[model samples]
Target: MGHMLWPFGTTWRPVRQRHRGTVDLRWLSARTWTRRWYPQGVDLGEWQGRRTLAVSWFRQKLDGTHLASRVAFVDLERSRHLDVLLAIDEDGMLQPAPIHAGGLAWFGDRLFVAATGRGIWEFDLSAIRRVRGAEARRVAGLSGRGVRASALVAVRTRVHPIDLRCSYLGRVFDADGTPLRRVLIGEYVTADSGRIAEYTIPETDEGRFEEQERFSPGLPRMQGAVRWGERHFVSQSDRMHPGALWTGRRDALERDRVPLPVGCEDLALDLDAKLLWSLGEHPWHRVVRGIPFRALGIDS
Candidate 1:
């Protein structure tokens, strides 16, 4: 609602055929899936093109899913859709499930999904099999595997005062060079202030999580988040002051704001490619693209 206000951020137009244009996932179809599982009044038409809801680099293809239940793989290197995977309501649940998935991250063999009202969910790569019965059409790489719950043990976030939702998940390291897992889960309290809680995920995915630290990064409607090296990248939507993507050091509290060409709903960084992918959710214009790695200064 607030993101729709005029000129949400500094309008930086993308360079034609270079950093410009969009990968319209809407063209990739998923009608059957949405018509059955998603609740009424849901728009399976398009993603509204604003936020980058789900993204992962899996098995050499850029796997992505959005609010429209459009699950497809894009070869960003070539800017083409290699496959369109169909969504399965394996559990026969997920009413109004279309827009519930907020973020996605890869955890070894499992893909973790931050389903807004459904809590966290996981899907096993090894368990993906063909849909049992679909007379309409079929896709090869698609699966009817059920989404399972994740054991985010020990991580206590209050729903009141602040609705601590799991915004995003990322991996980073600690001071001693030891690898540390981090989950960016927090809530916004007002139009100018909110809390950002970073949690340390256990070495074992099944174990409980411990609170690493909490930050009051006075940013409104904080959405997407990802971790790179010692810095944490976050997005904030402020109708009055153009939305922005911010970077803050994990060990320190100070943050530096980077105005995006578009307001990003979710963020995922590909360090190897040196590309920062963002999902822009502006009401009139929705786009997905990668910006230069140098822009964020998270050099590999």
Candidate 2:
């Protein structure tokens, strides 16, 4: 809603090809079962000199109850992972966060998770608590060595009173390809077109998002969206069939739709690695995979 506004123009098209070059994530067996927890959002960052992936997962049950959410931190080079439970500080007590963590974005030491219908919950990566002994067991039946993490605070709660289904922290480049600071928030819709908005990231510790542009992208069932330079990539899935990636420019109407892995949700772009990471949500077949930009016919 300022001078930094950019038009949100995009439309869906039929799938043209499939991105077959996907790098499967090596996940722990207990975390791969979707009946227990379904993976949603994904983002990659360097933590302690190691490339790591932070994936948000929500508890899955048949009775429409969301218990708590957890984030899986995977060491990319080592192919190992750790699950840390997400909690909220209620007065002085720690309670599980029960929102549908549909998307995530890692910026600096802060991790932003989308809370459906609410706003974004910000967590401090440096403040992840180590739970051991009785406290670990009491929290989530851990064997005295589990980890528990809590949100530092919730931000952007007063901005969008409607649904905020997905999020991504990416740069909006200028005409010469110079990167500019921006964060994009989007929604998922099955019946009609979905909307996406871009905001300037707050510099203060309050972490409020100043909306710059908003529009409906005409992409129904959108699970995630990310931007690189002038190009925007969106993932849309219906849970049963394989997902599709819609690639286009912010000022263009034509989009190249390509087939993605089944149950693909949120998207994260690793520019250094030239890979686009995503997560699959099906039970017994859940996966965290990185598809090459070449496979999507895009340069990193």
Candidate 3:
């Protein structure tokens, strides 16, 4: 495994504990002795006038089989969560989305998720279908009503053709507080320094993203990253060890060697609340917490 090198005169700061929040109990205990799903990405937005948080997860079976990915829509105010299966529409039927879903970003009515090397998958939030009974057990036509347990599924309508090259995807906003028409993608490398790049989000339906900027931040094991104006915050995990949060300009980044949760992955910022959100990926240790900007000693 590769190690991280800090800049000279780096000061390590502890993350604030008061702002941390965990997901609902139902999904929190979904990991059993045989089956498990690791939460990878998180982003919050307003849906139906309510604050909704979306968390992505990829299933892992005990036999070393990796299954389909899903996203959980958690109602923050209500303390309830709805798991939505990520799928692609095929011949009027739904097929599992076979992607890692390493990062997620909610922009306007579209939800963008990182598809690792394949690119970014775009889903229309307004097109999520609620599956019932038999339809929930099989990835077939959405129809049937018998069992009380229902499921939700979102089908991808389009894909942003930007190759991530195994990097995580996220979104950043401009100084005006408006989300820019660009996507931030970064890689996670252990032996060598990983690079972060920005791509323009196409405006039209048939348009393609054009590379806007690229830079090597020299951070290793970068699970996720987000930017606010000139400041960028990145989550770097060192497996079982405590994670670190790197913040500052791209050229001169500062590292807080302690504070972030263990196994931290993707990151998102709630600018209105002055909070930075991220999720842990380990089973039983998983949590979706938001750290206040003020607590990190950053201007809100």
Candidate 4:
């Protein structure tokens, strides 16, 4: 059984701080509910200067039958209705890109999605019928060619085009796929026994939220990550750290580890107002809201 190396997510609940940080379920408005969305590979995208979100759904088994995997394009305000796109598949069975998908990015006029073995797939929502998938080709001497790409983030937005690629061990590269830097995700105590950084990314890539930062745990596997304004949040599915939502800010540059909701997999936010939306995995695991958790006098 070959499985992608990931974090051992926890199955726990919110802790009471001396109130384990503040949790206001009201902060999240379950505004609209539609087809149950198994959201993976989440991020903010821009099409025509407007905000749109692209997410891939996990293969679902309904009534004991398997469902094909597809990508759902959502418009934030309109109706939250989903437009599904079928990805390239050889076996016709659903094999989703990594939960933490790397190939999807808003480049030029389209969204480029990296499939498991496909090099890159471009989708032009403006011209829905013009979607294109670039065949995966091997570069001589590259041991990890055509394998699944786990993550991709274009930090600079322009010239630098700094993109991060983590196929096996996390590594950084330029826009053209030339290797630049490398990072390891294991929680290895450095030669000095101190926790070495897992993935150090350029602040700019984190959005105008250059104030925000992104990184995985030294421990293998992470539930999900979201960046808003100057804060980046991740859910650590750990029993020991049940409902753990790790955070990092830019200005004060401090890390605030807060208690999140169990079963949370995706973190979304309206960062401007200090609001957060965490999507969960279970039926009863609805979205959790974090409203200015710190200012509310909540501490873990």
Q: By TM-score, who's the top model here? A: 3
C-alpha RMSD values across all candidates: 12.7, 9.6, 10.0, 13.8
After superposing candidate 2 on the true structure, give the runs of residues whose Cα lies further than 4 Å from its correct spot.
Answer: 1-20, 26-28, 133-180, 251-257
| Candidate 4 regions with alpha-carbon error over 4 angstroms | 1-37, 47-50, 62-67, 89-127, 130-216, 226-232, 239-242, 249-258, 268-274, 288-300
For model 2, residues 92-159, the per-residue Cα lDDT tens digits are 65556766788887775667778776777767666666554444433342334455331222212223
- What TM-score quantifies how close candidate 1 is to the native fold? 0.58
Q: Model 2 compared with the native: what TM-score?
A: 0.80
Pairs with steric clashes in candidate 1: 8-242, 49-286, 50-280, 50-281, 51-281, 52-279, 153-208, 153-209
Q: Worst 10-residue stretch by lDDT in candidate 4? A: 133-142
Select the stronger candidate by TM-score from 1 and 2. Answer: 2
Clashes of each: 8, 2, 0, 15
Per-residue CA lDDT of candidate 1, range 1-300, in tens?
112222222222222245433223322223212222221100011112322123421111133343233233333433333122323343542111233345555444344545454444454433433333331122222234333111101111211121355544444544343444566655533464556666655455455556767776666777666666667777665653445777767445344444653445556665544565665444333445555656556455
Model 3 lDDT tens row, 1-300:
012112112121112234343222223243421145677888878766667778888875567566677887666665555567888878877777878899998876788898887888888777777766665655322234534355667789798766456458778888766778777888888854788888887777798878888788877789988887887888899897768999888788899643676788998888877777887777655667877667778674
Model 1 lDDT, residue 242, Cα: 46
Tell me the whole-model lDDT of each prediction, alpha carbons only. Answer: 0.42, 0.65, 0.72, 0.35
Ranking by TM-score: 3, 2, 1, 4
lDDT of 4 by residue, 108-161 (tens): 344444332222233444433222222211101012344422221111112211
Clashing pairs in 2: 1-211, 1-212
